[model samples]
Target: MKQLIIILFLVVIGCRNETKSDEEIDETVYDMWGDFTQVHPEFKKDELPESWYFHDNKEDANRLADLVMKGKKKASSGLYLWYKEANADLPKAGTKSIITNFDGTAQAIIKITKVDTIPFNQISKEYAAMDMGTNIEPLKKWKKAHWDFFANTMKQGGNEPTEKILVVCERFETIWPKKQ
Candidate 1:
C-alpha cells in the first residue's frame, strides 16, 4: 500500500539521520582541533597541541578552566618535584596547548608567555596575584590553596612538602576562541 511505503521511507530517513549525528559526535574533538589549526597556521596539521584539563578533579578542573576562558586566570604553578617524579616535560615559553573542560571538551588554547622556577616560600605577592582565580586576598589565598595542592602532589610523588620546594610558575595568554 502507498501508506505503508511512505512509512517505511520515513523510518529509513530517520535512521540515516541518526547515523549521521552519531558520526559527527565521534569526530567532534578531532574536528575542533582541525578547526583551530585552520585558523592558526603556525600549528602543524599533523601535530595536535597538548590537551589537558586545569586540575585533578572534575569540579576544580572545570572551575579553573572556566577562569582561564574568562581571562581571570593568567598563570598557574606546579611542583617541580612532581614533574621530575613523573618524568613529565615542563611547559615552555612560546608553546601552545589546548585547555579542556573536565570532561575533555576543548575550551580554549593558551600560549605560554613566561616560565619561572622559584622556591615556594619565595613566591612573590605580585606573582600570586597574577595567578588568582578571584580578586580577593591574592597572596593569602594563593599560598593556602597552592600549599595544600602541592602537599598532596608531593605525597603522591613520594616526597614530603617543604617550604623550599621549587615551584614552576607558568604564565600564559589565551590565544584561541578569542573573547567576544
Candidate 2:
C-alpha cells in the first residue's frame, strides 16, 4: 500500500509538471481566440495566417486595426531593446503578419516590405505620421505621445524608456482584406 501510494503521487506530480513546446501551447490555448481565418473574412488562399495586435488594450488595438483596414496607417515602430532581451528575431521583409482587433478578432494582414532601426527622436515626420493611429497630428504630437507610451510600457515591464532606445520601424503593405 505504501509503494502504491508513492507511485500514484509520482504520477500525479509528473502530470502536473508536464511542459509543452511553444507551438503546442500556442495552438491549444489560442484556439479560444477563434480560427484566425474566421476573424479575417477576406483571407486569400495563398496568404499565411498569423495574428498580432497594435496594443495591449482593446480600444487602441481596435482603433489602429480600423485604420489599417482603411489604409490610413501604413507603417509602425517598436522598441527593439525589449525584443533583444526576448531573443526575438526581426520580422523578415516580405513575410506577413495578421493584425487583430483588441478583442482578438483577426482583421487584416500586412506584408512587411521594409524594416530598419533608428533612435526614437530621429524618426522622420513622414514615418511618424504614417505610424500614428490617432487623429492627433504627428507633426505636433508624435514625440510627446510616443515617449509617454514607450516610457510607461517599458516602466510597467520594469525598464525605463530612453531616446537612445533603437526603434524598429517597419513599412508594410496591406495584403489581406485589400481596401474595399
Candidate 3:
C-alpha cells in the first residue's frame, strides 16, 4: 500500500512538471504565430477563416479587434462556411474585399484573391457540373486580354506567372484550411 502511494505521488509530480501550465501554453501558442509571420511574408491574422476559433484571451482578442476596427485586417482564405452572402459587385476573378466573423463580436474584413479560372475550352465541362448556368462566352472571349494583363502584372511584380499562381494558390489554402 505504501509503495503504491509513493508511486502515485511521484507520477503526479512528474506529470505536473512535464505538462505546461495554462499561461505557458498560451505564450507558446502566441509565439508560434510570431514565428509563422517571420517565415511567411503574406501571412496575416485576419486571413484566418470564419470557422477558425481563436483563444479568447483578452490581449489576443483585443489585438484582432483593433485591427478589424481600423479595417487593417482582411480575410484571405478558408472554407468560410458562415459566409452565405457573396458580394455581387466584386469581380468573379482576382482579389476582392470580403467580411467574415472573426469571433463572436469582432468581424474581419478580408481581400480574397481567386487564382483559379476556367479555360475557354473546358468551360462546358466545368459548368456542366453546376446547377446554375450563365453565359460565360464573354469571359472566354476575354481570355487573351486577361492573359496579357496577368503576364504584364507578373512582370511588374517581378514574379514568373506560373510560380506566382502556385504560390498564391498555396498561400490561399494556408489561410483557409479545407473543411474536414
The TM-scores of all predictions, comma-separated, are 0.76, 0.68, 0.21
- The lDDT per prediction is 0.68, 0.62, 0.30
User: Where in model 1 is the C-alpha error above 4 Å?
Assistant: 1-28, 178-180
**Per-residue lDDT of model 1, residues 36-153, tens digit only:** 7887676755556656666556787787778888888888787666555445577789987767766667677888999988999999888887787676888899899888866764
lDDT of 2 at 47: 40
Residue-wise C-alpha lDDT for candidate 3, range 1-180, written one tens digit per residue:
444433322222101112234443333233434444556556655333222222234454445334333433322111111111121122233332212223333232233434323332333323322111223543353234334544453344343444123111101112321111
Clashing pairs in 1: none
If candidate 1 were superposed on the true structure by all CA atoms, what would the RMSD be?
A: 15.5
Model number with the top TM-score:
1
Q: What order do you get sorting by TM-score, best first?
A: 1, 2, 3
Better of 1 and 3 by lDDT: 1
Worst 10 residues of 1 by lDDT: 11-20
